[model samples]
Target: MTDTTARTIPIEAFGPGAQSVDVPVLDSHLHHVEAGEGDPIVFLHGSPTSSYLYRHLFGLLAGRGRLIAPDLIGFGDSGRPEIAYDLADHERYLDAWFEALDLRDVTLVLQDYGAAFGVSWASRHADRVKAVLLAEPVIRDIESSALPEAFVGAQRVIRTPGDGEKFVVEDNLFLTAVLPGAFLTPLAEADLAVYQAPFPTPESRTHLIRFPRNLPIDGDPASSVEYLARNEAWLASSTDVPKTLLTYEPGFLVTPTIVEWIRENVANLEVHAGGAGVHFVQEEQPQGIADAVVALLARAEAR
Candidate 1:
């Protein structure tokens, strides 16, 4: 029924990641892996990538605590239903996951596209969040995005032209554009298969197709306008939560101007070495990120 022609990608793996990997019988409900034993920390992956994205973090934190990372629906080994994907859809999944696992005292490690999903969840369940680590995270409204012009122009091309829907998600250019920018090093050719494995059909790209244009810039793109507003309000008022921006070396997210916007606009915000590290700082600087998270938890524990 599905095309098997996609090249098999050897998704990166780490034996040293988390101490134990227990996949509950949840099935395609959400492709997940759990390691270690302690307070639960769920890592949410960005679009076009799966739990495989956190391969390094799993190893780093598995020993000190519990780690759970899931592939969002239509992204990884998870089921790709024929449905529209949006911020609310992702929030629903996050709620179900936390409730299903009975998660509490959580620390969220979010990056890239995952920022939308994780930030939405944090805002909704503010009391449960213990701390936060955001790397090259997306927090801008559509108009304010500091992402390269090339990237934004492509987004406009694919979403406004009506025909943008066809290629935005399905075009190999999406993968080409995102890969080298986010990770510290050029991803191996084999790994590209893992990232590209999920969307094998035009229909399956429903979420990928819709994700970009949904940006809430200048409130033009109706759907995302409100979401960006809600998330910003939450971030601005989340004084009780311990929030840290683990930047990368020269960061891979929007641009420096945008980063300055976050620093000046966002309240209760702190910074780490995120802007100075590689794109996959979690992988390249897993220990430092993990240490920062643990320290946040420790502060929470102390409180």
Candidate 2:
């Protein structure tokens, strides 16, 4: 059974915010920023970023639907428990959040790790999902050969045992460097700080450090690869659900070859070129992402 009570929790306002709501998902309180009315447009962000990632879209798409962006359990303004923060851990909290809120006919807007986790959840409940919009989604296992050499080297360093902890946790490289470097237009210091504020200590960043490790590398993390496989099959077969993939120039996850593969493979999935960026398209391309969501809703309505 799912708890449908909407509990408002206190969240520190960062930049211009929406209505910040706190709902208990599992033992920890999960925080989300929300606004608007009518059907729900739920924004799920990737690593190191929170609902703050969708601040720009909150205003842009307020008229379009009910906008909700929740910080995944261990990240953002949400509670950080002393847990492993693995793929299953993330899904548990997210599932609870959805049930607590009783979100239905949802338009799931996803990016990065958000795509990996959210898409899998949406696929499982295709009847509940009204539509899906993806930006630089990690929908399948990636090839090392497809990535930039510099990025590959950094990934290796992050994957190494002690080096991974030192680089991501001790130095907070994801917030300080990797995140800033992903944007085509550099994020301002204040904006950067908003992303960095949640994980002030190494202990706070257990989830961040574990995110890259959760990636399906030679199927070592069997659970994550299984989820990816499920979603990929869902994308290929689910025609009733409206799916949109927003591609960008110099993209990281959705390379040119992957774009072609998606076009040929994923059923009822529309691909839109969203201009230039590598990974964090939200920083540079919020309006485009919002527009795509609005369009998806309209298309779904028409059907």
Candidate 3:
């Protein structure tokens, strides 16, 4: 029987005092911040952002469970090896990180490329995943016509040989332009500085440059497209998994059409209106996200 007497955990302030612990994974180390104890609730950030993206969530999800957020390899404080920052490389490092931590029965909170990684891992290791919350995830193949003309043009420039390096590396386009534009509220100078700290040198921006180019769009990037298809299939069949999808107004990836498709395809799914935002819903609706996550946890535990 389910524990009906379980009490709700109160949220608190996760202020500037929060610190990250580095764990060695593979040849490098991954920096992560964790709070509370018991079952693990892991948060994964995407391109141009680090675990710092979920700083607000740690406070909101306090005492509910063990909350952990890790910076992906080549981003934030994680070690940047000389290998190409491709999807497979990131996946390999993340797999090692999870093994090193010996994490089990995890609840994943994912965004952007993080969603892709998390969902892929969950599909492969279904027993380890307890629940999943996705916001602005890269879960489907994208059509070129579906994107804004200007955004498509920019992607083309970013995918080109010499121009891609200039646009992403030299100009720091993802950090300078894309990240700021995705947020509804203007990010303060200090907050922007945190996002910029990892990519000080042009060469350090390799992962950022690779992200947009690797987007699974229009049947290209066959590898990502294949994995997304597998994840979609898993989502359809995994009716026992409690999944919550937070959708925002004028969202970049998970548009209304995509949301409707998710409604039809994904099983045991709950959709929550995440209020106004562009791509970065966490910045705009942290409370809403927390509420959804808590509700999903309850549902998962009820089973």
Order by TM-score, highest first: 3, 2, 1
Error of 2 at 103 (Å): 0.8
Cα lDDT of model 1 by residue, 236-287, tens digit: 8887787777766666554566677778767667776643465556656777
Question: Best candidate per lDDT, number?
Answer: 3
Pairs of residues at least 3 apart in sequence or in different chains that clash in candidate 2: 9-22
Candidate 3: which pairs clash? none
By TM-score, who's the top model here?
Answer: 3
The digit string of per-residue lDDT tens for model 2 on 185-297 reads: 88888878878887788877766878887776545467777878777778888788888999988888776666888888788888888888778888788788878888888
lDDT measured at residue 297 in model 2 versus the true structure, 0 to 100: 86
In model 3, state the lDDT of residue 115.
94
Question: How far in Å is the alpha carbon of 126 misplaced in model 1?
Answer: 2.4
TM-score against truth, every candidate: 0.82, 0.92, 0.92
1 against 3, candidate with superior lDDT:
3
